[model samples]
Target: MSEAATRRGTTSIAPPDLLASLDPLLREWLPRQRWFAGKGRPVTGFALISATELLEPPLASPGVIHLLVQAEQHHQPIHVAGTPGHSSAPHADDCYQLLIGVRKALPPHLAPALIGHVTHGPLAGQTVYEGLHDPGIAELLLERLRLPGRLGELRFGRDTRVDIPFGLVPRALGAEQSNTSLVYGDTFILKLFRRVVPGVNPDLELPRALARQGCGRVPAPVAWFESHQPGAAAEPLVLGVLQPYLKGSADGWELALRMLAEGADFSGEARALGRATAEVHLALSRALPTATLGHTQVEQIAKGMTERLEAAAQAVPALRPYAPGLRSAFDALAQLGAEGRIWTAQRVHGDLHLGQCLRAPSGDWSIIDFEGEPARPLGERRMPQPTVRDVAGMLRSFDYAARSHQPWAPEWADTCRAAYCRGYAEASGSDPRTEPVILRAYETDKAVYEVLYEARHRPDWLPVPLAAVRRLAAPDPARDPGSGR
Candidate 1:
């Protein structure tokens, strides 16, 4: 976390000598927070694009914090855009982020609380917007929503391109760990990289590869945006990108929950999802095909997680209970590695939980979100550990949904689990008997990672994954929980 990672409206008594006035500035700043998104720290590193300072009144305007352009090396710059809040003080520092081609600003009520400052590079149009309040914002905000950074520029390969249609009203679709998504209309969604990892976004990179194999289920890319130049200090930064949106598509987890809710009879649905996923795997194999899973990668998965779990235990002692046992599991994995696993690494989904899968109303199951675990490094998420790793991610989702609404008994989760396993096996064409050992190992590895994640984030949910670790660490049941097949 950087020093400037948090900046709620509050100011330090010895606030920095920035140009903006203290009172009005702080008052307007507080409400712009993303609850799960990190908030509350003195903003230290800042560059400006344009400033639509509201020197007047009534919920000061600009309507929404739609977009801005001045430059942190801004792409499209807009200089002054706000409705002007009432203020008696004289303003001096006139620098502003340039919001390019500002046709309109949003209605007042719908404006988001926090808006961008300045942007630089490869952009054309611009707008400024405030944060969105759940119940509703003023009308100005609703009218003014900025299109995400340069959707026009995203290029997946030398030939393929993505196009985003305007006026789609792509509202914010809660973010995954790594990316913040906004779904526009019923057609497309834009995933803005939050902590951009280097190379190309796996979400953008691998999907293109899968698409090349002509996979039907994965949302085909319409466009992609990336920083022309990688920042020396920034390994992960959102340049921007867009994808064909699956309006009625349900993620694998949500789908599982629905099946569980409907009495755990996802035979048809699960089988379809399974078939679609298997076909995807096959398509991936054809695209950036690989031959074998390396021992190093497997050991790394286990070893890496064990280290993280150990580190987490240091911070949260409650996590200590599972550490020793987990280490034993990792030790066991060390003996086997990801040895002789028939599947090889191509570009696999880094994180393959139910949340990652989208089920369209048409009954076609499409997978999305190439960016792996948001917390892990880009390289880590992009790496191919084991095919079962992805399978385990889905299985984990099944457990989550089963017990999603019911935490204590988790009876429902069992049903979802059974459906998921059945689905995976049929789809992947694996024999149930063969996959369990490997799946259990992968599950253990995944649980360890989850343990660390929960311990660090939702301490209350720590048990959600910790409990998984305990299960994974237990004796290997006859069925390979790893292979959904």
Candidate 2:
């Protein structure tokens, strides 16, 4: 056992047993956390994969321990295959990185960070809490990345020729969903990926590739940390990424909401953002491999969309009424595919929405969060998809903002969506609007996804996507090439 592990008394008790004792606490705590993805489901158990003491006594006033734990949720398989009288696995699992702080007595200032007091363990009576809430621990984490080093199984390193300044006060960024981010002064922000999976996270992979391709629309990665578990077959799991922070930039989502509130036109801003999206897409196509989706592949894509719609309808009762209309969109896509319509597929921002964008003071848009959809598997997210998928997501986002702003501005959303597609056509030399069938299909799929997302995460926002479902499901006379309606 390493020195830090020994000090934490990992030698005294097996890791599984140690984590088992804390499972009750974690089960209660994990679901309450904003970053927890398994919300609305019960966390049945936890399997501790690795634990490293980032900071221990003597090195610091209080101690900090970093842990990678797999939380298993109770799940029932739809059907069991190849079994006469047996059920499949009852649990689905997701891995999470936890930074736990240990102290003999909780300071009043650290009260909010408290996870709970360790009832029985080597560190019994010690108050345990989230370490990221503590600025000292956050600063220490940045310092660890500042100098290339390995602590236990965790490796912290920077990109070649990258220099990170030390001793800057760290503050946590708020309103993040799937990750915890700490900003060091005004220089850099380190995003700690909460739900972790093995292999390269696209958040790091895409930014690095874009930087190499000389794409300035993304924040440049400075350093990153990953963990390699012993005997693990897969590649190292990315734990966090550090990138230069763009100061004074406003989130695109907030900007759109603001514009809607003031009745200000956003077509120009939307158009420029569309161009920026094209630039990034072009860079990604140059940096990575691209694929042409033939009839067979397009059929598969359409099938996937139908599957998703069925799943969403089952989950959200509001979608049931609109299922027939939605099916028409996917069916049209399949018919188009059957006609040998070929579409280009390449790596895209994946989950491009207003919130994933930022507008700088220079009026240029920069995209962030290349992790794709948080709900999908990493492999699926990494797959190349039609660029119109991204374009459709942005269009859906425009509708989302307009509807969310009250008094529902459908005209505003339509105007911005058209301007965005026009700008994209100008930059990429491919008109997304011209492919009305594909664009409509992608937009409907995105809206279906939003229905489930809002139903689960934000119930009040359910009407936003529900309304979209009705509109997209209905055939548009204006969309008919022969009809002027």
Candidate 3:
């Protein structure tokens, strides 16, 4: 550990003026980043919470810096409470884990990741870019994980039971939203959590548990690293995780859209995906502690759903018209709780969707990204929740994919939803449809979340969730009987 990587009193050592020099570059670059949670608001300033020089310059041409920078901004109210894009703590600055590479000059291929030239501070006249995009820096990260050890406050560890091969080429993946991923020789992929909070992230926790349970439905973690601040918090902040990459595996969203374009039936794939989801859920339940949500817990869940709807309605005028009807979903859920109903809860993939699943060439499905809603608190995400929450998210995803087609294919989405439910029922011994009230409430909550998200981020896509909002708020008994129709 270098002097700057050490802690003095309670503060992590930050090189003098390093953050000051990078301030302008980050302010301009952060908001435009896909993983940036504080979008729509300008970054006022940044405070360096921690900085670790993984490879110091003068010794290395392109040195790597691991930084936990807290960005100060005028954060908006949580868009839809507890949703993915919204920040967990609304009143505080957002902390980001950034792996930056400092180079005197950049090559052509690495130009896109450049933050800009630093004209002041320790890195004056050096070019800084996303470190993970640099193959050499990415390899250094893998080396750290390969040998379980500590670099300053950062610790790296791997599954000793598994051997990670060396000399794998690294390449950054472009499709991720809340994190950055780099593929290593088609054998391993490392996910660097962009927006971080202190605690063991579920992305690493759930998958490791599943691996021990011998559940292959989700890829097992290979190696990982985290920031361990002794005085800051009880738990360390999980920075990045390396897991086995499913080579030639097709993304479920892309596959769904392709099938839709070809006018092919996707119910089979949807059904298989459902079975895979249930398997993971079952493994999680068995691997982790399970609980029953009594009247109080149930009431809290309903209250949260209702509160989210109200918040979303306030932010989105369109949601106001349907707010009254939407409240009924949560109200009904609360009524059941008041009447002494109880539901089983357990650790679940809080943000499950088609996009999170991958179909291997052998037709098997594997789920990924157990980080839950990226912006939620790690502890809240790690808590037990009704498994139906995951089911509702996947159902919403099918609808999203269907809407992406030229002409909206409600039937296609409907068919996939039904097939998925049937498949889950077959595997889990409990159909999500059987819990009509819970399912409807969770699904409604998810739709309300989407409405606010799309309205805020992609205004053009707002109609997708608005359509669901219309259908969900209204009751057509002939078509569906679940919504008190």
Candidate 4:
């Protein structure tokens, strides 16, 4: 039997014919989606992993189908030695979760969600669209969370200690990347992970661990959903996580930008945020295992930083000139490691930045999104690293915010960064500034990563990190207060 026929024989929920016909529409629609990561690449084909009919025709106004699809993209081959005769794979596949809605006549309000009109199949002549945009279908998904149960291989789970009320109106968050989020009546927010991976996502894992440790700095996970494939030997992939929504909270990035615009002092807020971050780190360290990097490990860490700097220079030509200066920073770290210096590593907010924080109306800072760099492998992200890495990321964010605002105020970022470090020292009893070499190296490494990131993703934002690169590469006595020049 053909691939389509084999998939059709496996599932009885969504019609085989309807499932088979969605490939063409998905190929076009998926690339246009902001959450789709495989942009700029050709979608060669799609394979149906599983399709469950969430709401069937006649039973529901608009039919809803929960689809797990593996999309294959054309892979460009690289020349390698002794591989001239080796057969090359044509494409690479990535799994994506899509909730598709089918209706005969799409409502005017839902015109934005329309994928296209199905041409020929069981769903032919039907208006197919993204289901999350349809209010009724969105509500249905929330209902699944409210009543925890199993539907085929998909499982819904909720925290028994918490009570989640029913009938809350759902609205999708507009400015989400890498995932889709739904806010229900300002009480709860459900984040659906877009790219499916066969492991417990850190976003869910870390928050749950922090909640168990009684850490109030992070929103507690109230419920979640996951799916297990029939033959996969790996862990079940986490589909989504539901947590309490902080009402009347402003994101740290927005707060910083607003403060910068108004010429307001953000030192106090930055200090408080730093304290909150320290508390989270302390809590995580108490809850999870931590490792201390000795000579070998520290050397390995320095080598990794150096490798990243080299790679970034190769990718972004602008970084090439600053490579020597940046390599010096890494070299300093290597020297310190060679001298047998040891550093502590622990579970941290791997991807920390101003945007990853929120200032609640109560003036408390809450951390979210523990998922590390999205581009890195999952195993690498899961590994514990020096807490200073996170500190460097946030410090860079302060610089980014200042640069992003017109008429940049370098003094403002400096003040905020210093105050933040002071607050962290007060809370953690160890100041990051005291360890200047490691801290500076981490900050330099982070800026190098950002240079490459901004170059690839947002060319307009490239200057934000490049400015840091210039400042970091060329040490000015005025900027480096800790340096006894």
Candidate 5:
């Protein structure tokens, strides 16, 4: 598999075993990997869309891959992968063979326009070309990238092109923000989720409920996939979500770090972000569904935290010092369970972090990615916790923003931390009294978990959470109330 040096119209010496070319084995292999989106998916079969083999010289050195494989998804070919496997496959040519899938044959009208793309160039001492050159094959290529029109047909409306169709054989846009994304023809994006939680994925459910509840800011759901005849596992897995891609938007973390690093005043930005985030919690409470965040749920979550913490301590010895303290905090919170006060439950962003939020255009803060922490098993993730747990998570994130922005400068870290808490309190009208016990408990729990988390994945950043654990054990100096309200 030598590197393709040029591009041009191509020829295949051996008629590809369309099945081998379909890459069924690769699809089978995909579901088993960590990076694959179809976690529990049962891949039935694959369809082949005549891949443009740019180079396959006899001495092409066995396994160096430069491929453009169009694989079938549900019997229709799609531009599935651009690069090879997460790691290179076992057999040189055989590994790439599984990357193939099917393509839908496009309608006759689109033929002429699609065929215009077939051209020639040098790639691996050979000529490579793709586009509608094989009008028959090209039509098959085009159909796999599109869907039927609004009703009976399958093409998206013509004007849907964002990046528009380029002559480039489309590539499967990989996973992002915990959801799978595929950019086809540069006109549409397909998002798929790996963990198929039984109930509705909150990403769609809450946003739809909030929009009906008049909550703005969520990208309105345009099209969704759910079985009309619901199956045992028919909780819509969010196969794809169609929304206008935010142009010129940096993820909230990137924006915050840039703002903080530049020493720019972020008072207004902090306020707006806090307001929107607070509003999200409030909205989750107000509209959408509510269940008791009661003792039953609390005890289960406590047991889980205990298990995870104990396991963390076992695996990462550095986390031992905080185990007793972490256990104490959990026990103290469990006291509420003994008293039967764990009753307030609302739908929450299971995992809320800076990376999950976006600073959209117009300076509005938009929170996306409802999928919980990836490492947690699905059953554990579905458990209900206090909505303030989410608040606690984000509050921790603001601290993260400052610390992450300038590791060397401790100056003004306190000021930035206070401004953020100030923003949250003012927007949500959060009272320290109603949830004081639980809020502190949750925040403490978050910091301890952060300590254990940083120890494993990022040893360098371990001290931040260690310091936070110390700060939480003592009163947060930044949290002193002016009016005691």
Candidate 6:
């Protein structure tokens, strides 16, 4: 087919017949993917949002297809005695981006990326595998980004100030959770968001803002691509971002684990990490709109936290007994709001942690992955939040690392937490420790979130957050002097 014919084809570049044959394979293959969100529930069906042919027969050896598909799954209905308990809609739809590569025969090296044989599709008897694993597909994607233009519904763009080098070797990084990354010639790493939504993702939005502010703690994006919906009013969904890859850098997670193994102190590194975080926060505050949470907003924040706790308690029976104790943390915030105490809020790294940071050999810390919590709505992730939320996340990370160590090192976590707060205070001029009420509330909220997440995803790790739940529930007078013990 000619390029014009392909453009004029049906909205779904992959024909309906092809989708029908591909559905069963996806239902089987998707759940196994680490990036797939609908793991526990059964995939009822898949709806193709859009598809584009990046490469096909005659032009390329193996065809490459880019797809935006939604996976629908049903949640268990709640039963109540008073009413006939019928939920409005039992199913939920999660949109995902997939790059599928099709070939005639399976290659030994690419066997791991195989989805399975399509019994009846446009190309029946064609072998399909993940596109990122195919060098040809990766090269083609980079080429598209190199030249800014629109291809079908997808738009490719790059930072004009920086010239992107061509013919760079590509290799996908395997350690990511909800996204896949391809490192090109050890110079640029392109992150492909697997689970996609219909707005500008923070991973792309915040970096551009920080870059404009001349922030050195975060890497700026050099190239990116997004797909526009057919409707005029629909927003473009970001598909991927290409940024400079930091060579000879180690992530904070591995560094922390190694330090723990060597029975070394991590307080110095934690303090530096804290300072790095404060720098990023300062830059973001300067670059973005900042707000002061009024009494009404404070009350709403407390109410939201309380609501999350209630929902978590209902879902996980283990959280039921400690619900009252947990409620106190949020209630303290509400009480502070009642007293007319206000706090500053700004754009922050919504989901900050050890793994989100990298340390160069020179011992400089660089924060990465501003996508925030993957489970959160796009609007919520982009909203200006109290910086303490990020501080709480890092503190919890230290606790998590300590717990992962043999025999559990609570003292180490405590020392590191204090050091981190001190470093933040030194850099930001405001100490999180002084704002005990709000800090405790955010920490408690983070712990509740962790509990629910661990219970649902990693049952073995449930004990880690439960330990925090127990401690936060019964705030020690000595450890948490301002927790209203």
**Tens-digit per-residue lDDT, 268-369, candidate 5:** 676676677777778777875577756767777677667766765665555567677666656666778878885667777777877777776778877776
Which pairs of residues clash in candidate 6, taking residues 3 or more apart in a chain or in different chains? none
Q: Backbone clashes in each candidate structure, one number apiece? A: 89, 1, 0, 0, 32, 0
Writing each residue's lDDT as its tens digit, candidate 6 over 43-102 gives: 899888888877763245678888899998887553322223222222368899999998
The numbered model that scores best in TM-score is: 6
The full ranking of all candidates by lDDT, starting with the best, is: 6, 3, 2, 4, 5, 1
Q: What lDDT tens digits, residue by residue, belong to model 3 across residues 240-354?
A: 9999999999999999999999999999998898899899989988999999998999999999999999877877787789998888888889999999999989999999988
Compose the digit string of candidate 4's lDDT tens values, residues 1-485.
12221122124445467666887888889989987867656788888777777666434558777888888887654222222321223235878999898899888999999899888877777888999987787778877776577776788889988987777889999998888999999999999988787786888888989998999999999999898778757578789999999999999999999999999999999899889989999999988899999888988888999998887776677778889988888888889889988888988888999999999988999999987877677778888889998899889888888888889888888898988898898899988888888888999998998886676668788888888888788854234522211
**Where is model 2 more than 4 Å wrong at Cα?**
1-14, 57-59, 76-91, 480-485
**Worst-scoring 10-residue span by lDDT in model 2:** 78-87
Most accurate candidate by lDDT: 6
Task: Give the Cα lDDT of each candidate.
Answer: 0.50, 0.82, 0.84, 0.82, 0.50, 0.85
Better of 1 and 3 by TM-score: 3
Q: Candidate 4: list runs displaced more than 4 Å.
A: 1-16, 77-92, 475-485
TM per prediction: 0.68, 0.91, 0.92, 0.92, 0.62, 0.92
Error of 2 at 260 (Å): 1.5
- Residue 367, candidate 1: C-alpha displacement in angstroms: 0.9
lDDT of 1 by residue, 1-485 (tens): 11121111122211122223222332234224332122222322233322222111113232222222111111221111121211111111211211111113444554543333323221112233333332222122212222223221121222234443344554666544434566666676656553333465677777778777788778776665443233466433234456677766666666666666666565566556656666777677677746465676666656776776565565555556666765765666666664544445665676787777777777778887777765565667666555666766767765666545553435555544555566766767764326555666666667666665564446567767766766665555454463322
